[model samples]
Target chain A: MKRSLPLAIVFIGGVVFFISYFVPHYISEEILQRQIMVEWIKVISLFAFVIGLYSLIHLHVNKIKRKVDNWQYSILTLSGIGVMFIVGILLPEKFNGGIQQGSIYDWIFMNLQVPLQATMFSLLAFYITSAAFRAFKARSVEATCLLLAAVVVMLGRVPLGETIRSITQGFLDFPKWTQWILDVPNTATKRAIMLGVALGMMATSLKIILGIERSWLGGSE
Target chain B: MKKFFLNIVNLDRRWIFLMVAIVVSVPLFIPSNPPIVPARPVQELYDFIDALPEGSTIMVCFDYSPDSLAELNPMGRAICRHAFSKDINVIGMAFAWPSGSGLGQEVVSSAAKEYDKVQGKDWVYFGYKVGFAQMIIGMGKDIVKTVQADYRGESLKNMELFQEVKNYDDVSIVIVLAAGGTVQTYIYFVNTMYNRPVSAGVTAVMAADYYPYLQTGQLIGLLNGMKGAADYEKLINIKGLGTRGIPSQNWAHIMIIILIVVGNIAYLLEKKQTK
Candidate 1:
């Protein structure tokens, strides 16, 4: 009964949402979309966030209690969350109805969070160079072709790519060549992949709706 | 010679890192604006905005975070500048991520300030909304009803900018500057469902994947990464960070190319020696 009940709920909810898409009636269009679907989803999303917060705090608290390795990091995480929450609540709404501009919260987000994230992202350049140097060996015919394509595309996409074109008097234009590669071959491959993904998504949706995929309901009976 | 190649084959990566650092940093001191030839997609994007009738309202959705600020920010700023330069009204919103609301505000405010455009009549930021697809669909039906207030807690009902914009029908085009799947969401819900024209500005990595959409007319134009941003700045004839960063990018790309060539040569030499 425990398993069957949730599955039935899922089936009913899925079917209703699916039907609501096609039906143009006011009840289906307005009531279902605005009140039931959007409002409920928003409320559920908020609750889910709360649940996530609780889960995170609980995990960390347990880790600390058990004195796990790197338990000190948990303290840092909890402290960060606590401080941010306090600041957000205390700060006056300055800009739009959100956090106050130049408040401690905003300052932390802009100065600390922004730079940290950007710094992390910037590391990709170094890693890409290292990985390319290590793995991109022109050992075989296929590898050589790939290496050539990579060089051309890389040259074509940047300002230096255009410099080459100007220098060569249009006899060689990396930008034009890059555009051709991206437009034709790249687009073809991407479209095929997207088609496969779309079909897979549709099939998965159907499976969930028909209760064929109950793994979401948790462990097997 | 064989020993030299062997040493190079196992060369430490720190040297490559140092070269990249020097290549990227040297351009900042040397001001070189390499002539920008706008890619077809970027040119199309520029042309589309340039061709918009004066006083046309374009919906600019900020769907990216700071991680993508380096790329999307300049594109967003350039589009806003273009819109303001042409006297096109803007209705800004963020439904992708919460952080987008703040980023959107910064872009709009800075552009509007430069153009001496007022907030209510010239542009309005609708701020972040919770539900992604539902919020979009609702905006399609009734934007005022969906988004009750602007980012500043002001009621959007009284805002002059939104008076003409009832929904997607009233807007000229919807341009989404995104680092995530929000572009696809906008394409599906806004463009496909409401039949509204859509365009996108995405990070370089995600640019190649969206070409099919551009080809299929689902996307009117696309701007990919910092290079794309540089192209837009050139078209507008206003040099920004995008322009400044291009030299660095050019130098970095050249460095990578040199590294790859050198690495491959070393590999081939090693292989030949073994044979």
Candidate 2:
């Protein structure tokens, strides 16, 4: 009964949405998909967020209890979440509370969170440089092409790339070449991949709708 | 000379890290004006916003986290400044991440303040919502019903900006500044479904992925990483972070190229000697 009920719901919802694209009637497209389904989604998404938050806290708590390697960081994570929640939501409006600008929530977010996240992302520069120096070798024909492309692209996207035009008295334009590579080969490859992905997604969605892909429902049943 | 090349090949990675750090940092202090010839994609975005009539509206979706603020914030700020300077209504939103809402508020409001643009009237931020695709699809049908309220819990119905602007039809363009796949989501749902013109300011890593969409005319324009931000800043004639940060980017790129070339040379030398 549990499996059948959920399957029935999925089939009805999926088929209606699938057919709505073709129908385009005001009631189906506007009222059903846009308004009605959208509200349901918003509500379901909120619930999903709550579940996600609970799952996060639960996982971290379990890690702490287990004394796992690097588990101390979980405490920091939980503390951050707790502090942000209290300052962002639980506090009263009289105290300049809430996630609005000028609030404590905004202050922490801008000062602490922003810099921390930026620093983590910035480390990519150091890591990529080290990795490239160690591993970016042209051992084969394909590797050489990739290496050459990478060098051209790296030079082309920066100010140094544009300066090539001035240096060669307008004879050499690395940026222009880079743009061609991106526009032609890059676009063609990306389009092919995207089309494949879209088709795969449609096939997967249809399978799930038709009850052939029941993994989302969980369990073997 | 062979030993020297071999030593370079075997040098500790810490040396590379130090070299990168030095190159990236040194350029910040010794500033030079690197001429920014605005790329075609960037110029298209600038021209599109420039062509909008006064009182027209555009939706700026801050679909990135603070991790991307360095590359994306400038684009957002530049777009807002452009829109506000021309008396265009700005409807900002961050449906991708909760953290993005803070960025959206900061970007739009900071620019709005410069032009003395009133909030709820001249500009309104819908803030973060949980449902990304559904929220976008809903907004296409009716924005007020989809968003319900602004970031501060103020009803969208009360906002003067909402008076004439109701849905995707009212929005002049949707510019998404994102670091992730949210831009693709906007492309699939908003552009493909509703036929609303979409553009993006994405991280350089993800920029190449969207070129196909640009060719298909799905995206009106694109901003690729910090360079794109710098290009937009040049067009807007503002020496913002994008401009300030470009010199460092230049040096870093030069350093990476030098490293790659040197590494390859060392590898080839080693190969010759072994043979």
Cα lDDT of model 2 by residue, A18-42, tens digit = 8887787988977888766888778
- Score chain A of each prediction against the true chain A by TM-score and list the results: 0.92, 0.93
Chain B TM-score, all predictions listed: 0.97, 0.98
Q: In model 2, what lDDT does residue B6 have?
A: 79
Stretches of candidate 2 off by over 4 Å are none
Which candidate leads the pack in DockQ? 2
Which regions in candidate 1 have their CA more than 4 angstroms from the true location?
Answer: A92-98
Instruction: Give one digit per residue, the lDDT tens place, for model 1 in A1-221.
Output: 98999889889989998998888889987898877776667667767767889999999999999999999999999998887887777544653223645567767878887788778888888989888877898888988888888899999988777777888999898888899989998899999999999999999999998999888887777
CA lDDT, candidate 2, residue A60: 99
Write one digit per residue (lDDT tens) for candidate 1, span B80-120. 99999999998888887877777788889889999999998
TM-score of every prediction relative to native: 0.95, 0.97
**Candidate 2 overall Cα lDDT vs. reference?**
0.90
**Quick one: how many clashes does candidate 2 have?**
0
